[model samples]
Target: MAKLTVERLKKQFGTSIAVDELTLEVAQGEMVALLGPSGCGKTTTLRMIAGFVAPTSGRMLLGGNDITRVPPHVRETGLVFQSYALFPHMTVAENVGFGLEMRGVSRAQRGPLIAEALGLVRLSHLADRFPKQMSGGQQQRVALARALAISPKLFLLDEPLSNLDAKLRAEVRTEIRSLQQRLGLTTLIVTHDREEALTMADRLVVMEGGRVRQVGSARELYEEPRDAFVAEFVGRCNLLPATREDDERVRTRGGLLLSSRRRADESSSASTLAIRPERIAIEPGHHAEIKGQLEAVTYLGAHTEYQVLLGESERVVVTRPTPVRDDPMLSVRTNDPVSLTWDTEAPRLIPETAKD
Candidate 1:
């Protein structure tokens, strides 16, 4: 395993830039996820690192060696493609040993190495099976084994779990995380799923418009987002246009006053007050700090989502655990008057100038 560094990495197709001044570092034995929506350049960034796509400008270092111009086969980076690109005619053992063969390992020497890789993914028994005969999950494991057989300096995965069913996806992700930790592998994964990133990565890099928006742990991104876009994109957030009224207060455009734990920095620009769905509390009466008309109620199994319209236009979603039998909220309906309140520290002030 090796530490990977990218400096001012950029990629462009003609006039359109796919990645813009991207810089990141992945520590040895740590897993970092590149998270963003489709077309945000995450896959492009990964391909650049893996030497599949040449960068327009910038440098990449692996274990203190400059590898920006290295060929893909010589980069010593194992990459698992999104489609699990396994040759249909090859048996699982042959697929796993292909990388070793490319590196000049003889057939006599490749047997134990292939067995070890397949064992790491718990697929040793299926080594004789072909890709077309195995389930999707099994095929994914075979691809992982193939990548692992080469003992790569850097491990890269591109949406490795996207094709699996929900239950299988969860199980496979857990297995991957466990194996990565056990082997102390330095990994970089490109994915658009927030839950997958949050649960699997040691750190997350959130990207938008081909540039990084924020890089931090899941808790830091969710609790202390730097801007409106990061605040809303990382999770469900209620963003209302407001002007800073004081050190701890802001008045929303809809004529409602709210308190925030963070004071807006001394910028006079319009700001946004961000509150999490579960932070706001609602009661049956209209006597609280803010009153709103309940617009809709959605039962989401473990939790209930309430859409409340505050004043003329501000609609906020508040989530709470499902109430027990005889609870008054269980009987609340749409269009009912409700009182909303929250602790002074529940809301955060973010610059409204952040563009999507």
Candidate 2:
């Protein structure tokens, strides 16, 4: 396993930029995910690292060696495509040994490598099956095995589970994470699914508008988002337009004062206060720090979500574990007035002009 480093990487298409000065490092044997919505440059960055796309500027290093100009096949990086990219004419074993063949490995030496790779993904029994004969999950595993067979220094997965059904995605993601950890593979995954990144990665890089917004562990990004974008992207958050009134106080646009953990920056013109839905507690009566009318209640098996209307237009959402049948909240109806409260540290102040 080796560390991967990208420094001030930039890419431009004609006049539009696809990736802008992106810098990140993946530690040896650590799994990191590039997480963001479409066209946010996550895919472009991955392609650049894989050598499929050339960077407009900057450099990349793998294991302390400069690989900025290396060709894709010679880079010694194993990449699994989003589409699986398996050839229909080949069986699983043939697919797994293709990279080795291209690298001039003799057929006599390829059998054990192919078998080991298939075994790692629990697909050794399907070595003779063609791509068309397998399910999506199986095909994805074959693609993974094909990548793994090379035993490259860096492993890359581009939306590896996107093509699978929801249940299959869940199962396969768990399998892939387990395999990556067991092998101590230095891996990087690109995905738009927040849950996938949060659950599978040691750290996450959130991107927007072809630039990185924040990069940290799941807990850090969820609990201490640097701005409104990171706060809302990593999880569900209620972001209120706020103005600094004091070091630890801010007045919302709706005229509600809220306590925050972050001290107000004197030079900033505005701040956005972020509160996670799960952190806010809903009270039965209108007697807490803020009062609101219940607009809706949604029961989601293990948890329930409540949408509350504060003032005339501000809306806040609260999430809690589903209550028992006899719980008082079960009796509350839409339009019922309710109060909301949270610990003083629950709200995070986001500067209007925060940078990555």
Candidate 3:
């Protein structure tokens, strides 16, 4: 296992800056994810670490050794791409052993190691099958085994499961996490899938437009995002513009006064308040509730999402448990009168200018 450190890492393409002085660290035996949308420079950062894309300016270190100039072949890092990248004509055992063979491992030493690697991914039984004869999930496992066969110091996965179907993706993610934990390998994964990053990473680094937005655990980013962009991007939220008052409170444009722990004295006369849909409650005929008309209802398997229009300009989203009957009491339809309420402590206040 190795600790990976990136210092002021940067990459540029012509006039556009891909990665802008990004710095982060991955502790030994820890799993860290570089998460963001396309063209956010996450994949470019991964490529830099793998020596696939040379950084315009930066330094990469592994276990206190400066390897910024190391070539890909001598980096001792394992990489798995989204497209399995396995040789179609090569058998599973042969594919797994290819890396070992390239390093000139004798046949006697390569065979057992290949078998062990396949067994680690639970593909020992299919060792003789070619890549063409295997399912997408199976092919991915072979690719993983090939990476592990060489016993690399670090493991890098660039959207490794993006090609698999939903069910297979989930299953394979679990397997990969389990395998990494057992091997105690330090791993870095780059992905745009929010749930996958939240589920698999010990810590998440959210990037935007070539800069680091926020770096924290899944729950931290979900509950206490630093700004409106991070809040909206990491999860579902309802943004309501409001004004900062003297008593540590914010009054929304719709005449709703919300109490919060944040003092908005430094903020301008206008600010934005964010709340998660799950935090909002649909109370029936409550006088203290903010009045709204149900605009739409979406029945998700575990919960029902309601788009509530408050007053003339304010809108809030609320999610509640799905009803039991076809038409339950909470089965509010479009244009139906409803009240939206939530705990004041749940609201996150952001300066209007901080909003993206």
Ranking by TM-score: 1, 2, 3
**Ranking 1 against 3 by lDDT, winner:** 1
User: What would you estimate as the lDDT of candidate 3?
Assistant: 0.86
Span of 10 residues, lowest total lDDT, candidate 1: 261-270
Give TM per candidate: 0.97, 0.96, 0.93
**Tens-digit lDDT string for candidate 1 (1-356):** 99999999999999999999999999999999999999999999999999999999999999999999999889999898889999998999999999999999999999999999999999999989999999999999999999999999999999999999999999999998998899999999999998899999999999987899899999999988878888887899999988877777889988777876555443455388889999999888688878999999999999999999999999999999988799888878999999899988788877864442
The reply for model 3, stretches above 4 Å from the true place, is 253-256, 263-270, 325-331, 351-356
User: Which pairs clash in model 3?
Assistant: none
User: Residue-wise lDDT of candidate 3 within 56-104, one digit each (tens)?
Assistant: 9989999889989999999989999889889888899999999999899
Instruction: Return the number of clashes found in candidate 3.
Output: 0
Residue 284 of model 3 has an lDDT of 46
How much lDDT does each candidate structure score?
0.91, 0.91, 0.86
Give the per-residue lDDT digits (tens) of candidate 2, residues 110-196: 999999999999999999999999999999999999999998899999999889999999999999999999999999999999999
